[model samples]
Target: MRLADRIAVVSTEDAVRASVSYDQLRAGDGALYWLETRPEVGGVATVTCWRPGEGARDVSPEGFDVTSGVHAYGGGAFAVIDGTLWCVGGDGLYRSRLHDDQLELVSLGSFGDLTIGDGELLAVRESEHGDDLIAVSLTGVPDIRALATCRGFLGAPRPGSGMLAWTTWSEPDMPWDRCEIWVASYSPRGQVGNPVMLAGGSEESAVEPRWGPDGALYFVSDRSGWWNLYRWDGHQVKRVAPIAGECAAEPWELGYASYDFLDDGRIVVAVQDGPRHGLVVIDPDGTVRPVDLPYTSIKPYLAVQGTTVALIGASPTAAPQVALVHLTAADPQVEVLARSEHAKLDGAQVSTPTELRVHVAGDREVIALVYPPTASAADWRAPVIVRAHPGPTASCLLRLDWQAQFFTSRGFAVVDVDYLGSTGYGRVFREALYGRWGLDDVDDCAAVADHLLATGRAVPGQVFIRGASAGGYTALHAVAQSGPFAAATAVSAIVDPDRWAETVPRFQRAHARRLRGGAGRVNAATVQRPVLLVHGTADDVAVVEDVRELADQLTAHSVPHDMLLLPDVGHYVATSTQAGTALEAELAHYRFVMTAAAAD
Candidate 1:
């Protein structure tokens, strides 16, 4: 099939069939419950319940959004309590009766990381002042009591048998940067004692607290340069296993669980080592054994009940799926429970990514996932699309992104660079962009483009770049800094760092100024290549004014460019329809630029 056909299949056909984003995986009452968000349904989060023999069923009511806007990047939106599901809906907490579809609003507040224990549900409620952990009773007027209050934020409310554990951090520091783990005695009536800081400090980031089968507290901390597993043994914190891999996940959103304790003294963990991932079992004695799993990408959401492990897993060729593994079997057996989408394509047509370590400035190495064009023609080199991922802090996982396939199927080599500020590498690599945000990322993108052209993996003078949000800013900055890319496309691009500062949180304002460098305003003379800019009119992250100001600058300089203002969309174009349109427009613009270059 052609590129357009592949795009259509990915955007409509496959998306309609699957389009699932699962999280909040919980096991209780000999069953499992998970939250599934579907873009086809306008990205509404729904709770799905599954029994060993009864099959899966949706417990969420129709027209209800079981999600939280606590951190914008929402997670830990729902909690399953005694077979009943409690979720954050709109501006209130809603509880759903599992047997029937009846839903009731339990409380009036925005909540996340809902934890249930001792006949009560605990959550971190977000408000204008800050975030606090509060307990909502299941009965008796449904009284809400403040369990723990932090000066800045509180989340990951994990209520154990008789103890309550949560993570706290103040502003100027994201959760991944630095967070403290606190534990308190729990009582059915109310909190019994004061919460004590167990592990973590201003320099250390401790997250994902859970109680073992033996009632011991376990968590992941980055005190050893890499995020590793640790346990709080009564008085002090002890290491479960001091492996050099990062088991602690970045808390970009609230409800993430990376590791879980089995009834046996074994703990199953998902570790991020560079671009690859592994699933390992850590015994009580700190012995680690790697479990052979077929999936390449495993989400932080994990749940374990006895010998069963349930997770959201994906491979290089498969979309994200809800999978269950039987750990007790002589050979661990994996069963596919639910899939987001099943794209029917031949194995040969799918391009498997090859991880590359490209050398950059200061003798540093940046990783890039390269996908060769999956086309019949082999003698000719394909034009490359260097896609800089968003989050500047986030790395592109080794999973099947149909959007990348849309270009690869059309005989284009795609390279996703994990530049300097990306996670999954240790804290040092993530902190590489501490004072230099846009410049370092911009250089890394151009460096990868240069490496690809030098190696003849990409066609010269035909390299194109695409990005969104932070990545968009890098794309625009890279194009102006270098002469490698023939054209570039940026969606919700941050063109001016100074103007962009106003849109971000108060804590990031200083870091935003560092992005303002020697690169002055882009004009017709400075930027010679054609550019395409797409911005959602309702984008609140990098406000519309940033794009309008850049458009005005481009117009004043008479630079060749195209801009599209999408209505009602926010910082991200959530729907597949909008994404497909943006992809088509980007490809069309690239073709026009290539044709003009060829004619010249």
Candidate 2:
């Protein structure tokens, strides 16, 4: 088929991704009125909030750093109480409750955690020596009382009254590892019971423990291969819903896989639906019914305040937007509370992404989803954005990405190719990266690009690569070795194996497996494409030196390159205004190269 029928390549303003820019979430109350922030600095995360009636606008024009400027720690885990937000800031826990939104250390001494428990607030904390569960009163500084002696650390406090329940697990496993679900009684006086263990699965994997209004404990477990719902009704761990053949969402972090609650004897959860997902309520009798959603490719996740459902969601042509819905009450109209103004400003051209099987190198079918260029191709051939996701362990999903559409709007087709090592497809596929990495994924990416070019979706000379961290490495290394991309960009990437081995997080130190094929340095000499490198000087994770070495190597190789070094940025370049602009600049550079290539 000719590219004429395609709406892409049209030289018009409507084909731009400016429809969604990004919103500095002000505040999120009832998921209706709230602001959500990812990064306030190099290693910081913050959220915005506003008082009712006046609106999120009047509250504050700025986001409060929940991490309290601790540069080493990347801010993430947070909880909201009474109108103020409490989170792990820096080394300790801090709360933002002042009119000026100044952060104050609210613990007895060290930083642990503070959460609303049994009508008041309680601090569930962790120290290097061990874990201690403390009780905090929102009326004043919470009285610190140890919870009968915790082992590793207390899980996010299960909000409850009368009888209280919480989960705890040992180290290395994190929270999702095998955990022990404990149920005991609590008093404002901070007393506990002998605590009967309801269900202690593996020592490495149980989380999102929701003590229901029905007096039952609900949590998601992966014991069944798929992370499904498990119920502890004071006895055996029963399978409430045998949800199979699909997953709701892949794990983004410790508590990201799935969040659900027990409302009306029904287990309400957010799960992976086809192409998109949403809130699904499952009855104890085994009937799975979906709560009608207001949008597509999106759904509400966690339930807070017993009534409000917090949503981490997306649209077919837009980025994920955090919205709120009142599920505990009648009339479940999704209230559009907080939005990434960028999501609204960015123009997303909906091109259905289907999985491609460009199988090579191994048993796994290499996956690549193509988003056709958003213009009429009659005038010119198009470019393709080939992305190699980080993690080599990280799984790339088909969710909304403003960055991808940003290029598609600029007359470039995009393919988010999940090389052999990516997750979501299961352990078999994920483990493929173990011994393979650089070789298999690179082969898969190159093959996908070849497949797209051979099939005519991309001009052979115009394929380009862009990735963050490890993905950036893939992009750079691939363009270096083979394939014809006009250019490539690597962000916060691990370019030097030896330097990265020295600085990257100890857990990720195994990165050499991908570069050396389990042995020596994998030279960037294979790359000849013009490369743009982005990194934050403040980065403690990937380290500034990683990209610096890449820049040096690129220069030594005589490769065309431009480097953007952020002053106080870290791994993800979070909360930096320059991030989006820098991304846009990368797109512009791609255009310049591809246009030139086309001219030639």
Candidate 3:
């Protein structure tokens, strides 16, 4: 098979049709429910329910798109309350019983972080003004009551016992950077009393507030330099089975449940150490024991009922699947609830990632995941691609990434750089990019490429760098600076940090400014290498105009570059029909660069 054909097997529309993404796992009333995002259906998200005897079935009402627009990157869009599934459909909030087709509209608006309250649904509603907490009536004619109005962002409005808990953070700080958990007396009639600051501050980031089975408010805090579980027992807050690894994932979206309570009063928590993820059971007496599982990566959303846990798990060889684990068994067995129809690849076709650490900046070690070429050739160095993950805050996982495999299977080595600002590491490491976003991230990517070339793992003058969103910004800057990279591809790249800060959504305005932190703008004049710029016309986060301006500058400087702008596409291009086209263009761009360099 041709190299392009091997790459197409993972990047084409057929691959998208064969793939599925599961999110928001929730268990209640002896059933497991989750949101399945199918790209074949135009990325329509629907709720599915599965039971012991009965097979899995879609429970979302026909013609209803179960999604939320609260934070733009919506999550926590559905909740199972009293046997009825309440979800944010395309036009309004709706409720329906399991296996029933009767969908009743509850309210109209963009809402997320859906939680079951006392006879009501608690959610965070987004509007032009700002975000606010609201209570929706379960009965009567769609009575929507504002529980709390805040000038900043609000999410995870969990209601338990007689109190309602939620997270709030203002501008200039992302939730992971800084946030507070608040609690208030909640009445069944949708009335809320004065809120009290429970736990969190500028220095301590707290999130994922859940009411424990013991009526204590449990949450995740990074006070000890790592995101660990904490419990608030009416008057005092205390750590729960404290561990060095992060027990909660970054709050990119609201309503992530990293840990859940079992009926036996034990806690099932998903802990992430570097790129690997595993489950640990914490006893009431503060003992933590690892749960043996085959999956290497677990999503943040999980639920526990009795000793049964429902989660979305993935490994190097398998796509993510919704699974149920019975912890009470002698050897806990994972029950496959739903698996994606991905094309099965043999061991020879798969490239497993290994940890690569390089010391830079005078003893500061940088971490990365290196995937060597799966196609073997004697004494031939492979071309390398250094990937800068977006979020600038997010870390690359150990899960099976078809995109990375696309290059590895085609005789290209891929290195995913986990720069200073990336998560999965502790807070100190994550916060290292606070004032050095573009600078440190760019250096890290360039350094990784340098190390690969120096160690003979990468072909000299054939290394390329690529990224999306903030990582795109890093790639653009890296190619502009002195580096071993021969070419660059930036998707939805932030061309100008100042402009990005002004045009980005209110939630991340401060984050943009903080990340930029005294860094100069991208100097297109310094970019001598070929560049490929891919952007979506409808991207609100990194507006298309900025990329256009950068392209104009590159043209003015007589630089060789190609630009691909997809119409009607948003910030994320992974699932779009145009994704395959973009990938092909990128591969061609790199090949052309190599050919030109070899001729010279």
Candidate 4:
């Protein structure tokens, strides 16, 4: 059952990776492909197609990057008309076409500030306070609205001739801080010609417009503090790619998001690296190149037919993969083609496993995301998993997360730690939980679970441990300090950190002053093992009355636990039936601790 063989499902785990949001037409028949997944987990987004002349390329196993928000942005989706492509996901606005030779799917609608014009399709099915109504869909589908009007649409497709231009602002202003970029002109006899603002949003921040060849507008601004690229020329706007760089790319103080046109005067832009991402390129006379590559994070799309981009770097072992590069291939290399297979020897060849970082107390360091179940350790055995991630501030930042690729493809040896108050190692490691929080995030998750059991890499007592939400209060305070872990779980958890700071709510009463600690508490005199809880009766943010008051204090001290709950969830358990109810309460408490750690 190791069929992760292309059409996309990727998980040759070493810490996951992939990202190429929308390469024209997009996914399935929309052309150029190779993606992994994410749209809140299980909307499958595994792709890898490339059809044009039919050099024959079509890979898809993933699905669900949702389609209407609330997580379904498997890069929103592209491919239009001719071959038919337009996906957002599920019952919101799908569409797939190409039939017999493949491409499947066909109808879906929900419409909102959309775009895609030429044969026509512009939108804004609904909006609020600022007032709305600006539909228009001739053939781009959506129960054909021909023209609705009240004006407020924006991209999803609506740039060229369908004339999908719009602008509006009214509350505390932040549509680029003020607003104005209207340009209506659609007429199959619907008459529209009174909207010509054509670019505004000042104090700076015009945005990623596009269409300068014969119409002249192009965009991306920072009013010149850094984001570069300008152009208006009906008598002044200037600068086309004024990039200078110490590493330019900082326009998102509040969204209009990155740049992307390539051929309308070439460009890509994202840049930053060594902290997150950096994938530059430009020209209109400023010239820039920086796409060197040890990669920090990337996703540069653009294969509209040529200039060929489709990138997606990421490294520390893996997570994020897709490459094509062909700015006209001077020496331009990078053809990875497709990887991410190991769901446990489904043809092996993973990579990302060497960030061990030990210790915890005052000398911090913790960090993790390992997965060494064996790619050679003289043929490694299994049983380890500590795992945690639940935004200890949001980042275990090492990508390819197929739920830790199903515990190292069914053999088990995951890690995913990043303790000591995690978050892309910055701002003093996200204020190392400011004050003190659960003793340096509980000795950084019991020093990444006893540094994988004093480095022999585990076998000694089977080991388990888990987390969710502040790493489920650091896996119930690392099983109440001193971690060995025969078993442990805690979905939507946060056990009694003093009633999560007095009946936690008010968006978390200041998160218990950032987890202060040391007077010690996580009781049942430091749990003995078998715990598993998994709440979610519509959790109002980590609430099942705090897992039924910590499962009645772990069943009045008998310890050995089991809870469950979940129905109409919250705090996202990330489906597959909540990962089969956390793999049947973690393999029935590790098969009763692997039959009592093989009878001691």
Candidate 5:
């Protein structure tokens, strides 16, 4: 088979267009509700509900695109309350019965983080001024009222037992950096009393506040150096379970739940221990036990009804699926509800990753998931693609990544680096890149390449680096520093930090400023290898103008480079056509660089 055809086997345009992403899992009164985003229709999101005997069906009306624009990257778009579904559509708020196809418009505004309260619908409404926590009466003629407004941002408005709890953070500090959990008395008439800070401060980050069945407030806190479970009994805050792993993730989007309460006073939580993710049951007495399951990667959002837990899970070979676990069974079984298109690939085409720990500057150890080429190679050595994950704060989980497999099937080894600043290793490790973003992360990527080369797993001069968004920023810096990479590709990369910080949404402005860390923009003049720049004209996060400027600099320096700009595509090159085009262009660039190297 031709190289392009081999790559197409895993990442064809048809498969990309047919791909489906599931998010915001919620369990209603004996039904499961979640959001399904279809890339074929330009990323139209719709609400879906699944019942035991009825099967799964879409509940969102035909013309309604159930999505929230809050925080620019929206989630928590819909909530199920008392068998009725409340959702935020493009026009405004809408509510419908579980099986109804008609949607009743309640209000007009941009909202997210939908929460159910005492006869009210709570959400964070985004406007030209700022974000505000608003409440709409479910009983009356949908009376809308602003409960609280902040100068910075507000999200996760969880209401329980006649009280309200939410999180707030100001500029220059992302929610994971520093945020406070506040609570106040909430009246049935949609009135909020003076709020009091329950936890979180300059030295701590608390998020995902939930009101347990016991009327106590439960949240995740990083005060103990690891994000652990904590409980507030109205007067004092106490640690519920002290696990060494993180029970929560950074609030890039709203409505994230790492742990949910079970009816019998136990908690079913998703825990991230390095690159591996799993579930555990925590008893009220502070005892914790792992839940045996087949999947290795699980999203933080979970929904529980009775003893059943609903989550989105994936493994090395299996694609992400909406699954339900019946904990009451003799042996817990994962009942698959919906699966992604990649699930059709045979097991032989899959490349599983093995965790590798390497030491970089300051002798600090960093984790990297190394996947060997799946194709049979007589030479045994293959070109390596070193990938830096976006969200300098994000960790790459052991899931079925189609992009990674697309290269491995064609005899290219892939290495996903979780550098010094990655999460899942605890708060201290996550904060290690505070003032050393580019320096530490870049060094970590280089060290991984070096380790692979030394072990004879990668061709000495055939190593390449690539990243998107923050990861792309790291790749650009690494390739310019005369690293071991033969070439580099950056997609929607942040070439100018100052420009990005100013243009990005209010929620991530502080993150951009912090990640820059005294480092100036990438000097395209210093680049020494073949560079490929892929960006979308519609990318508001990292504007296309910045990439154009970088391309101009590369041209002035007489550097070998190619730039591909797709029109109308957003920051996330989500559509199948765009993704396939980008992947093909990237593969061609790598092959051209290899041919030139051979000629030399």
Candidate 6:
């Protein structure tokens, strides 16, 4: 098929979308609820429930914006209690009986981490001062009462008999950086007693606290330099099957669950090893066994009912889907409950990624997933597109990405580079870019491209780079610092580090400084290749004005470039329309640069 046809295939509304988004996995009463975003519905959060031998059903009320806006990057938006569905919506907290078609607004306010217990919804409410733990009565009365306050941030409020366990972290420290699990005594009268620290401290990061059937607190902590599971035995915490792998990810938002305890005391958890993940079950004696699964990517959202573990997972050939795996089965039965959407590509159209570990400066290593062009009969060497993933802290996994295939299916080798600061690696690796952000991330991406060239995987002088947000910053830096990249495309790129920091939340501003550093600046004059800047006017994170200023500067320096201003869009290309436009703009940029190179 033609490149345009491939792009159209991936960009169409019916294309397979990722169903297992953040904090969308919840299970109760033998049923599992998976929150999905449908382009047909303009990417609205829709809850789909599944039961044994039953078909999937849409439980969310029609036309309700059941999404959480607590931290901007929403997650932990919905939770199911005793077959009743409670979700955060625009007007406040909303509830829908699992089998009912009617919706009732229960509370009024933005909330996160909705944990159900004591006949109420306990969540972290976003207030003017900061985030606090509050209990909202499940009755339609909208009676909101504060359970805990004066904390910079609070999450994972697991309510149990006479106790409430949650995680807290102050500003200047992201959840994965430093957080503590606190367990407090609770009373029926909405009274919260003094809290006791279960695990974590200034130098340790603890998250995802939950109470088991026996009322023993369980959580994940990075005290040993890896995010591993631990059991809090009222007075002390003990490591559960300590391993070298990561059991928790960067808690960018609320409602991150790496593991859940089964009724029989067995624990079903997802452990991330580099970019791939493995589902494992741990007996009380600490005997760990891997569950048979075909997926290479698994989210932190895990729900366990008896011996069955439900998670959102994906393989190289399949988009992410809600999966139910029976742990005790002789073969570890795996069942895909709900998919993101029907995949538009056949098995031949999918590009399987080959892992690439390149040793860069000082013998330090960086990892990336390289997808070769999928043209079976192409005669010429394929061009390469090196993508710097966002969240300079986020790692690129080996999942089926339609966008990456959109390029590979059209004779372009796409490389997803996980730079120095990416997670999934240990904390030491993650903090590698602490004092060196733009420089290290930029160099790592370039290194991946250079490695591909050296190994004869890419066509020389035909390489391009593209990214959005922080990745965009790295893409721009790569062009400015060291690049003969045919062309560069940056969506909402950070032109100035200092200016970008101002737009970030106060807690994240410090990390922004670490990424940009004192000498960080985007010199338009230094850009040798053509550039394309795509931004949305509604993006408050990397405000459109900041990106526009960079585009103007590029023009002032007479740098050949193009800019696309999308109105009413946010930091992300959410809607199908926005994604289609961005994909087309990127294609145009690549074509323009290739033509210009040919002329030269």
The global C-alpha lDDT for each of the candidates, from Candidate 1 onward, is 0.77, 0.58, 0.84, 0.52, 0.85, 0.78
lDDT of 1 by residue, 408-486 (tens): 7677888999988888889888877866766788788888998888877778779998888878877887777556898
State every prediction's TM-score relative to the real structure: 0.93, 0.79, 0.95, 0.28, 0.95, 0.94
Pairs of colliding residues, candidate 1: 18-340
Looking at candidate 6, the ten consecutive residues that score lowest on lDDT are 13-22
Q: Is candidate 1 or candidate 6 better by TM-score?
A: 6
User: Who is ahead in lDDT, 4 or 5?
Assistant: 5
lDDT of 1 at 344: 55
Tell me each candidate's RMSD, in Å, in order: 3.0, 5.4, 2.7, 22.4, 2.7, 2.8
TM-score of 1: 0.93
Residue 443, candidate 1: Cα error in Å is 1.5
| 1-600 per-residue lDDT for model 3 (tens digits) | 765344323445545554578899988767888998776666678899888899898988765678887766778899887778888875678888866879987877788998877777788998778888988777657678888888788999888888888899986578998999999998777677888998888888999999888899999999999999999999999999889899999888888999998888889999998878999999899999999998989999988878889999988777788888899966888888898756454322567777999898957888889888764554447999999999988887787776677677667888998888888889998888877877888888888889888888899989999999998988888888778999999998898888888899877788888887645578889887889999999998999999999899999999899999999878877766577777788889999998998999
| Count of clashes, each model | 1, 53, 1, 35, 0, 0
Model 5: runs farther than 4 Å from truth? 1-11, 14-19, 82-84, 96-105, 343-348, 375-379, 574-577
Candidate 5 residue pairs in backbone clash? none
What would you estimate as the lDDT of candidate 4?
0.52
Q: In candidate 4, which residue ranges exceed 4 Å CA deviation?
A: 1-123, 126-162, 165-184, 187-265, 269-290, 293-296, 299-370, 373-380, 384-412, 415-563, 567-571, 574-593, 596-600
Candidate 4's displacement at residue 419, Å, is 30
TM-score of 3: 0.95
Candidate 3: the clashing residue pairs are 172-510
The whole-model C-alpha lDDT of candidate 2 against the native structure comes to: 0.58
RMSD of 1: 3.0
Candidate 1 vs candidate 4, TM-score winner: 1
